[model samples]
Target: MTAPSKQTVCIVDDDAQVRRFLAEVLASVGLVAEQHASGEDFMRRWQPGKAACVLLDIRMPRISGPEVHDWLRDREPGLPVIFLTGHADVTTAVRAMRLGAFDFIEKPFNVQQLIERVNQAVRLATDKSAAGSGNDGWQRALTRREREVLRGIIDGKRSKLIAAELGISERTVESHRASIMAKAGASNAAQLAAMAAGQPPLD
Candidate 1:
């Protein structure tokens, strides 16, 4: 039998140095890292269903990371996208996460953390591909309140913020969050966010 192909991680950044460094790091972990010098370059070269995950730089020229993410959402809804942002870009990154990004890593990130997040993203992508429409069951099982709380969590909102928005107590929001996780079989918010990607809007 032929061996399974390595998972590909596409790194889209304006800085050549950043792309090279990320390529080296991902390669060290047995992942195939495809580097793109700019968002436009990535857009041109990217093919649907080609990459398991994307490491997108948030502050790129022209297309920008969020813009590229929008394109990805429309084209490859199931592909995980992890934004690479600087300290100042954290807010923007969080907003992107709300829109279905897998996760975000701030600049000067720990190598181990990056590897863990990337691995998680790859696993999520692989599981999603294998499951096909299987995820629909869990999604259908979520209560409307659970779904609303889940949308807040995926948006990177704090429990307090979600509570305020929903006009419920923080404890209530936490309860909904726990229920959502249990129903979705997700151990954490990141996994929940990944599973929710491309799903219908909770609203």
Candidate 2:
């Protein structure tokens, strides 16, 4: 069978063995893998296209994964980033997620889970690229809380249910819903949900 895309899975880790293992795993799943010894090396080769996703080691000499992620945020915001960490901490995971990391996995990650997240990220990035420009504006306009509410709504949850899930009051959820609709320029809940799911708004 053919590979998913010609784009490569760029792995940035200081350890040679880890890089080798990850490359092998990705190959088994029909993904092209490219290795870099450090963040600087990866940055030197980074380009806008043909990168399915980045597997970045959290700790590296000189430029760290978080720093690389920050740079990518400005240079290539559409690129998906997945952090690899030897020491998994709540603080680090939360921070990485906040910065748009697809997912964070520890050193001894489950092979299945790793493949799943990587493939999922690749698919999501591909969809975003295929979607063109309409989704970007709505995505950028949403606040974090509004995003959470939109997700719940998209999952077919009621406003009260979404509020409970987010640990906020229903009124707050309603307010967020209103703000999200305004920002997305969606006429109704259905249209707002469509916009959140990366579909173009209806006329």
RMSD of each: 7.5, 8.2
Task: Give every collision pair in model 1.
Answer: none
Total clashes for model 1: 0
- The worst-scoring run of ten residues by lDDT in candidate 2 lies at 178-187
Full-model lDDT for every candidate: 0.78, 0.74
Error in Å for residue 128 of model 1: 0.4
lDDT of 2 by residue, 144-178 (tens): 78778878878879988998888998867765665
- Per-residue alpha-carbon lDDT of candidate 1 for residues 1-203, written as tens digits (9 for 90 to 100): 11134298999999989888999999898899999989999999988777878999999888899999888766776577889999999888877765567778999978999999899777766655554457565666566887888788879899899999999998677656644553454556788789888886344
Query: lDDT of candidate 2?
Result: 0.74
Residue 201 lDDT, candidate 2, scale 0-100: 29
